[model samples]
Target: MLVEDEHSLHAINVGRRLLVQLIETCKELENIHRIYAYVESTNLDGIHFYTMMGFQRRETLPDYFPQRASLTPDAVKLVYEIGNDSSTEAIQTFPVTNQP
Candidate 1:
């Protein structure tokens, strides 16, 4: 889920497309129920992006990245529950702009 900084892929909806495809593909599987990700607490932009993509904040994970010597070592857990009809319907209605 990493994109090169030089490319500026965010402006073109790359992340949105990837998440949509992932949800769509996972929805077809009977066992898949939710998609979750841990983002550094200091990463405000990352948090905003995921929230905008329909993920909800689950909890704050303390010492999530012990190896990293950062000011904010805690991580925020985000989850997108795809097991219910309402969640799927929300995904289907997400706005995605087609960029050439």
Candidate 2:
């Protein structure tokens, strides 16, 4: 799971870099074939952000979100295929310079 503080003041690229590094790391793992993220349909920013990060919209799950008194919404399933990429295999390690 990935999350960021809403009140964070870090540079935008910082999040992108971290997410890229996560994908790279997942690609290196032998058992991990793909990365999946579930986003609420009402969350346009999240939908756009994951889409921009090479995740493809695969399916729309109806009533995926819990039904609350206030609101309920469908969920968008996004997936990133990390297996069988020769390029990602070369990157075995990355330095940890920042903590969030």
Candidate 3:
């Protein structure tokens, strides 16, 4: 969910749509679930969006992603257990020909 709003205004909706598409697009990958990544806790909006998108907050890893612009001194990790739920079931149910 790498959303960049040069102005940081009136881009939430666009960011949301892009994020959704990003996830769905990755579904086309072969065995992509086994990948790993990291996210900072200060990303409040990201946390909200990921949570609503079914990504669960795994734990609050201190100093995970060093705080910036004020140095809060902590960060957190959120995990999205994708490709193994009702969500993926819908994708798998679709006809193979419809995938793109």
On TM-score, the candidate that comes out on top is 1
* Candidate 2 C-alpha lDDT tens digits along 1-100: 5455243634566657777988988867876667777776666666777789998888987887666554335777887777655333322221111122
Q: Can you write out model 1's per-residue Cα lDDT over 1-100, one digit (the tens) per residue? A: 4433223776788777878898888789766677776777877777787899888988988876655443466778888888745433322222111112
Could you tell me which 10 consecutive residues in candidate 1 have the lowest summed lDDT?
Answer: 91-100
lDDT of 1 at 82: 82
Q: What TM-score, computed on C-alpha atoms, does each candidate reach?
A: 0.72, 0.70, 0.59
Looking at candidate 1, what is the lDDT of residue 92? 24
- Sort the predicted structures by TM-score, highest score first: 1, 2, 3
What lDDT does candidate 2 reach at residue 25? 81
lDDT of 3 by residue, 10-46 (tens): 3557755755675676677644442122344555655
Please report how far candidate 1 places residue 49 from its true position, in Å: 1.0
Evaluated with lDDT, which candidate comes out highest? Answer: 1
Q: For model 1, what is the alpha-carbon lDDT of residue 29?
A: 71
lDDT assessment of candidate 2 = 0.64
List where candidate 1 sits over 4 angstroms from the true fold.
1-7, 69-71, 84-100
- Provide the lowest-lDDT 10-residue window in model 3: 91-100
